[model samples]
Every structure is written in C-alpha cells, then in structure tokens.
Target: MEFDSEEEAYDFYNAYGGRIGFSIQKEYGNKVNGRIISRALVCSKEGVKGTDKQDRRIFSVQAIDVELASDLRVLACNAYELMGRKSSGKESIGYLKVDLKNYLRTRRQKELLYGNAA
Candidate 1:
C-alpha cells in the first residue's frame, strides 16, 4: 500500500489497529531537512509479552492476600473484575488460574528462603 503523507499512513494504521482490537503507535521516523521521510507504525503490544510487568500485577494481588490473609479465589475475582472494568465484557485474561498458581509457588519459595515456612 502507498500513502501520500505520513499522517495519512498513521491514520490508516490506527484505524486498522482499532478494528483488530489493538492500538497503533509511531515507532520512529527518518528526518531529512527537519521533515519526516520515513516512519514505522507498530502494534502497542509488540515485544511486550512474556515480560515481568504483568507478573508484577500478580505480585500485587499476592501482596494483598499476604497482608490480609485473604482467600485466593476472592482475590482472583476482584482482580479480574477490576481488569474487566477497564475492558469491555471480555475478561482481563485467561491465565488467572496460572497466575494464582505461580503466586503460591513463589510464596512458598520465599517462605522457605526466609525461614517462614512451617
């Protein structure tokens, strides 16, 4: 595909991303005489998966359970509820159970490391 201008390209990709349930971002541009000559648009989620960022959120939920001695199920429910509020009817993710399991395993490792395990 070809576009007459960078703005037009951006708008086209942005709309495409919206239709595909993601967002587009301007990655970078080549400048010549203070004018954008070339640019790249990409999905906002590019190169972001399998990172510790989302794990950090899970750790936050783990903190709540540790401090309040809360039930894991309730914590998962509340976390998913909050995530859903930010999205539409679609759930935050399908990995809540896996996250909870990771949290429990991590907590056990920590307890063992700090002599808190029974």
Candidate 2:
C-alpha cells in the first residue's frame, strides 16, 4: 500500500509486529552492506508560506525498486486509484487501526477463555 506521510508509514510497520529496539552487532568495524537494506514507503508534509504564516500540508508515497520501476509505479497508481483519495497515509492509518483493534479483541478473548500464548 502507498503511504502519504511518514508517520502513517511507521504506524503501518508497527502494526506488522515490527518493534522499535536495538540490535546487537559488531560495533567497531563490521559494516553490513546489502543485508540490512529495507525498502519502504515514505510520506511527507508539504510546507506552505505566507506573510505571517502558511498552512503546510502535503502527503507523498515513494517506492524503491531500481530495476522494477514499472511495478512500483503500477502499485502506486493502483493504490491511488483504489483509495479514491490523495492521502495514502490516511488509508494506511485506517487499515492499521482496524487491524490493531481486532488484534486486541482476539487477545482478550484468548486470555479470557484459555491462558495466553505460552
């Protein structure tokens, strides 16, 4: 899915069981190259200017696949077409919220009926 804003992108990742933490590694001189690269969608807020103040609001989604530009473009275009709105970030947030709510309900049911994941 396309993401219009960065926060929405992060929220999507978080919904996918991705955690924010640290990874232990060789700190001194071991630099991993291709093994650590991640492809993601990015969103941005545009800035508006005025004499005193300006409303700054814009959303963007980017897909990175150097050799698969056509695929990425198609995906983005389809997402836009499907959403029927310009904000992909908003769509991502809505999806995440729905998923999280369902997850919480299932977790509660499991805890009430049985014991929890052992």
Candidate 3:
C-alpha cells in the first residue's frame, strides 16, 4: 500500500483501476523549485476520451509527499472496492466521490503529521 515513488503509485493504481473498470490519469499541480508540489490521480471510465471535465470523474491522490502517497493509494483502492459493489454506474460513482472525500481528510491529517517529503 506504500510507494517509494510516483511511478509505483501510478503502476499500482493503473493496474487495479483496469481490473475494476476504470483508468487512472496523473494530474500534477504547480511546480516548486522545478519539483512538483502536488499530484493526484484521476480515475475515469475506461476508454472514455476527452478534455471535457464533465466526461470524466477525478480522484485526487494526495501524492505531493512520497510518504503520503501510500496512504493515497490505499484510499484509492478502497474507493475502487466500494465502487465495485454497486450495480449501477451512477450509484458506484457516487459512492466513490463520498469515500474519496473521507480519504482526502485522512490524507490531510497524515500530511500534517508527516509534512510533505517531495
């Protein structure tokens, strides 16, 4: 559940996302001193393509800190599991959004304790 690098986070999420009927996209925030200051994973429907924000759903990974990336990955996987239990697409996505918010809160707590290590 813990990753030492962003690549590991991506690999784990992408593979799991594929298995659960979604695709993961990496979104980077502004840079600081040539290093990324923030990062997130956007999990959308598999094969859905477009720049339109409405066409896809997004999940923030909270990967700015290497240490917290593992937590974020666990959160994502948990959301995926919650999503898998739903029979309806809309219902599943709704579950994911709610679960993601709770996970984000937990990630913030970890960030406060550990500080960003990027």
How does model 3 score by TM-score?
0.34
What TM-score does model 2 achieve against the real structure?
Answer: 0.21
- Residue 14 in candidate 1 has what lDDT? 95
Name model 1 segments beyond 4 Å from true.
47-118
Q: What's model 2's lDDT at 107?
A: 48
Q: Which candidate achieves the best lDDT against the true structure? A: 1
Better of 1 and 3 by TM-score: 1
Of candidate 3, the 10-residue stretch with the lowest lDDT total is 58-67
Count the clashes in each prediction: 0, 2, 0
How accurate locally, in lDDT, is each candidate? 0.56, 0.33, 0.51
Which runs of model 2 end up more than 4 angstroms from their true locations? 1-88, 93-96, 116-118
Model 1 lDDT per residue over 1-118, tens place:
6689998999999998899899977754444445655565768875433534344234343345433433444464565554434333223332354565566568779889999876
Better of 1 and 3 by lDDT: 1
For model 3, residues 31-109, the per-residue Cα lDDT tens digits are 4444543445667533434554344443433222222534556555554543443323333232344444555667668
Q: What is the C-alpha lDDT profile of model 2 across 1-118, one tens digit per residue?
A: 6567545645665555334432221111111231212233322221222233122212222211211333344443444333333223333222222333344455458777876643
lDDT of 2: 0.33
Off by over 4 Å in 3: 45-118
